[model samples]
Target chain A: MKQGPLDLSQHFLEEGVVDLSSSEKQSALEELCAITSKHAHVRDAKAFCKAIFEREKLVSTGIGLGVAIPHVKIPSVTDYVITVGRSEAGIDFDAIDGQPVRLVFMIAASEKQTAEFVRVLASIVKLVKQNDVRSRLLEASMPNEFCSILREASR
Target chain B: MNARTLVDHIRSSAATGRLLILCVIIGAIAGVFCVAFSWLLETVQYYLLDGLAHHESEHPVWIWLLVLPAFGGLVSGVLTTKFAPEAAGPGTDAAVDAYHHHGGRVRTRVPFIKMITAAVTLGTGGSAGREGPLTQIGGGIGSFVATGLRLSNQERRILMAAGMAAGIGAMFHAPLAGALFAAEILYREMDLEHEVIVPSFIASIIAYSIYAQKAGWEPVYAAPHFHFRNALQLLAYAALAIVLAASATLFTRLWRVVRDAFSSLPVPTALKPAIGGLIAGSIGVFVPDALGTGHHLLAGAFASSFSIGFLILLVTAKMVTTSLTIGSGASGGKLGPSLVLGGSLGSIVGLVVQDLFPSLEIDAGAFVVVGMAGFFAAAANTPISTIIMVSELTGNYQLLVPSMLVCVLAYLFVSRHGIYDAQLVSRLEAPSKMGNMLGAVLKTIAIRDAANHTRDLIVVPEAMSLRQIIDLYTSSEQLAFPMVDPDGKLTGMIEGRDIRRAIAEEGVADLVVARDLARPHEVIDIESTLLDAVQRMTLTGLEDLILVEAEDPTRPVGVLEHQEVLHAYDRKLMEK
Candidate 1:
């Protein structure tokens, strides 16, 4: 299957809503769970969060250049999915640039799709390097606008 | 010519013309040094062996085993401590430090110290390569020349690169590889402007030509040619690349381990090298091929005559010798020893695989060359330079594809953890905080403070006429003013945009107060962090942000913008 920005939406964004804040971590986690439970096949948002947290403990997914790519390989999904989220308020993810992350791409993939998942992740990194595309995504106001901006960028 | 005249002459020459001349000078100088360095080393070897070649009948191998390394270690220790301290150990770090921080200037005395010390170290059988010292020598020459000419920082950097290329070309007689090494490995980037490329190429070619004339052009290695008979062999080649990458990592780790161990010791610094030499010589007693640079042994491996067991022994011995020699504080290059060790590993792998699958006709030597480049790329993180170096040294462009593939694979494998630990620390020290803060402060002081001071001085009745507000901007530098309606609420802000756009397009100067140019979202709350303020600016793509009191949303506190933050940080750094 040809995976693109839609796959990212399904994997990263929990529901139709994404929460962004500076001082509160729990609110962000709760919002992530609410969104995932609505859009994701896995009904347990807590388990998904646990897996992502474990991955983060291994190495900060905040690769330099103001980007954070957090991923997990979970048995709950039979296929791979990726999602992107923007926080205009900026979250402290311990990024290499010492700058808080404004964009997050969360990925969930099955063991069988490891190579394909990695290839897609590399492509996403390349895509985000475009200054204009990143700026447009950061400025997106709502879920519909965010999705539209991602779709146009991928195209 | 006088120094000033010489500097002026160099500066006036077209970039290409100056580079060509510099390259020729570097090449000639490097070639002479290489020949002298080689001869001096051979003399030490002869004295240590008592004028007897390897197969001499009566000479006790034990005498060579004991005396040579002891002498090498002691000499290296004394030379390093007494003379050029910067020339101690492997030359790579010195080059990197000079390039990044020293404005591409190395002391002229460094090359002389390196040549003498390296020759003595290699001569008595110090387990290191000559190439590293030669690179330092070349780099030093470039630095000295540029400094003498008083060149601009950019020009000096290019000249230093050119000198390094010339040195590599002279030492290896690989011109193209030398040029690429300068642009790729030394710089750590492939994107080069005309200014860098022109000089680098000229220097490499000149160095190669001079060395070739003196040495009569020796190929790095000679091998029997073989063609792939089936697609399965390509798979074998891919497998070879994977193994090479892993081995490269091991080599890099071993070097680090030895360096750390020696450096952690409490002994007097000068004596450390002697101890390393003693250990290397003890190892050399069992494996005689580990004595010098191992060029002869590398040549032997390509002939399919070196046994797999012997190759393994050589690899271990060379690794220990090189690590100890360099780790302890000997002045030398890691490039030659790394290539030799990596080539031996590949050759052994090829021999074992061919033996198991007797039907497959594969030349192990071809794998050796590819392994050399692959290992260098992985260890050094310079794939382009390694690829080009291998192709140029062997004069075999046909191996480019395999070389490139192997190099890239090896590079990726090693990069997961990374080879250079120091680079990670340095990269973390970017000027991000200072830059951002300075940008913010500058914007505030330049625009906001001036406006606020004017507002305090200029007082008008609540029902100010449009003519008076226009007169305020006309009489002073405050082009914009916040207008408060009679109810003490800030109704709007007026600026040049409204007046100029009206005058230019509508052709009317009907005057208005600050309320005319006020946009709905021009104000920000006071409680936000500086990061928030910066993001708002970034998102709106605006030059300024108007600050309003949080308790009273309509009342203006002050304005903050890009320049305010920048100026503050700039002043802070200047004071420091």
Candidate 2:
């Protein structure tokens, strides 16, 4: 597939996992925003990437155990959205434990959707915290399998 | 005291009781100051010209008048210039400026200097009143007390205004009116300094009682007994209001013109008052009653009537002499002169109307009383206080309704301008109130007015590559971008900054998808306001917010940038 619009499933479509082409946190954010632009309603791709990077600059969003959640409240989007970018090769996201990040969850929201934005973030954090879910997400090799695992974990 | 201690003192509730006690002391001091000031001015006049009144010298004793005023002015000028330059002009202006700008601080020496200078000015027949000096003396006492107590600026202002009320109350024996004047005179528009009202009343009453112990508890002016017999008399009073307001407007403008002329004179500043005294002294040579505060003349006008022509001439003479006296920096209050003019104008109208219809029992004294109130209302833009003050001055409460009618009419007629340059339009315009005004503006303005419509935004697809985004960024001036899914459901926003970062990272752009790289931003519904947007923005540390269709949260409408909201706020304020 020449790759349809950057869908939620498309993020994990390539062998159910994405490789970290970027070396560091900043480049990883840039790469993720660039690919996400294929489907996200972003007016400016670079702005979207920089906003997430700016959020990352305050404190490393890399929670630990090879997971990072980078988010931004920007004027460009009309709704809350979540995209998962798996970096199998391991990217230097400056995780709390000083470990490289393997799973990257980038969330984008409008300035007004505060309640939904917060709720979605909490859900994402909860889903990522489950040991079985993390193992399943790490083991999945197909887009359907990853999507099913995320759906179950989210529920 | 150190800054921290001062701040702590101001924050404490104990300061309020301390300030109230201080106000009582200042009021008593101001009352005594007024009495002593009046006595000194009288003594000076007695020594200067009163003794010469019965002189049998071949040379007309009036010849001594020519130099007496000039001499008084010269001495007054020297005293003011040498001791307290702020005490030079009508003291009320200095006191007003002190309250508005100087944190309610006046030099401790000002009241003493003003007393001596104003005494010389009036005693030597400088054609001025005692109220101006009394006002400064009272205000100085308030400042002295406040400074001694180490009170906060707010407490100082209250006491200062109270002191002023005390002085005026003692001088006129009208405590209520004095309190009202202190609160009302600081602003040109119909705004009262409400915080000072209770303190001012307390001070004024104390001062009035103390002063009345010496001056006797009688009204300042005595009027012939009169009653509002018929409703038709209201028409005459209404006419009096219109005419007096016109005269007062003319008087106010002329005073400013004369003051400006004297200000531009090339002579030494100290000699300016002397020159003004010379002209007033020459006029006084003929109409000596026009000199001093015009109290005696104003009293006479109310007691009896002169010919219409003579009364009119007295009005003109009093106006000219007063403008010369105070406008040229002679120490005096325009209040006394305004009362004299109003009385003279009223008596003239009474004479004409009485002559026109002999059947109508039109009391000229009633007109005189009404004129005093209405004229000051026009000049000072203090209708309620002027009416009350005039009634209190004449010891007549029955004339309240008529006086109120005329006072209000006169005030409305010429209230567009005022004699006090230090007067602000209202508390809203005061420097202290600006922060509150800004808060009010932010709270009141809706997002609909502040937001930039979605159609005005630069929209780009979520699937667009970083290279394509860079191309769009260079082409458009938009700072915000709304990302959409394949179904066109609004998914995420990409600020222009993020795109630049992507391009800056070089090779990372090709590998990363826009959806995964996109950051989720807060969305504002169309129905929300700027206050809501600002609150959310502050909470999330965001500068710009996306607006969505109210019916559908997922549908992008417009962008509400922080800068745009601020611009709208500015426009709204300017409109106000």
lDDT (CA) per prediction: 0.66, 0.77
State the TM-score for model 1: 0.58
Candidate 2: residue A109 Cα off by (Å): 34
- The number of the candidate with the highest DockQ is 2
DockQ of each: 0.01, 0.02
lDDT (10s digit) by residue, model 1, range B347-414: 88779778887666677877787878887777767788788887766666666777777888777766
iRMSD (Å) of candidate 2? 14.2
**Model 1 agreement with the true structure over A12-89: per-residue lDDT tens digits:** 332443435532333454445445544455545677778666556544666655667766655565666566666777
- What would the DockQ be for model 2? 0.02
- Residue range B530-562, candidate 2, lDDT tens digits: 777878988987777888877888877887878
Q: Comparing to the true complex, what docking class would candidate 2 get? A: incorrect
- Top of the candidates by lDDT: 2
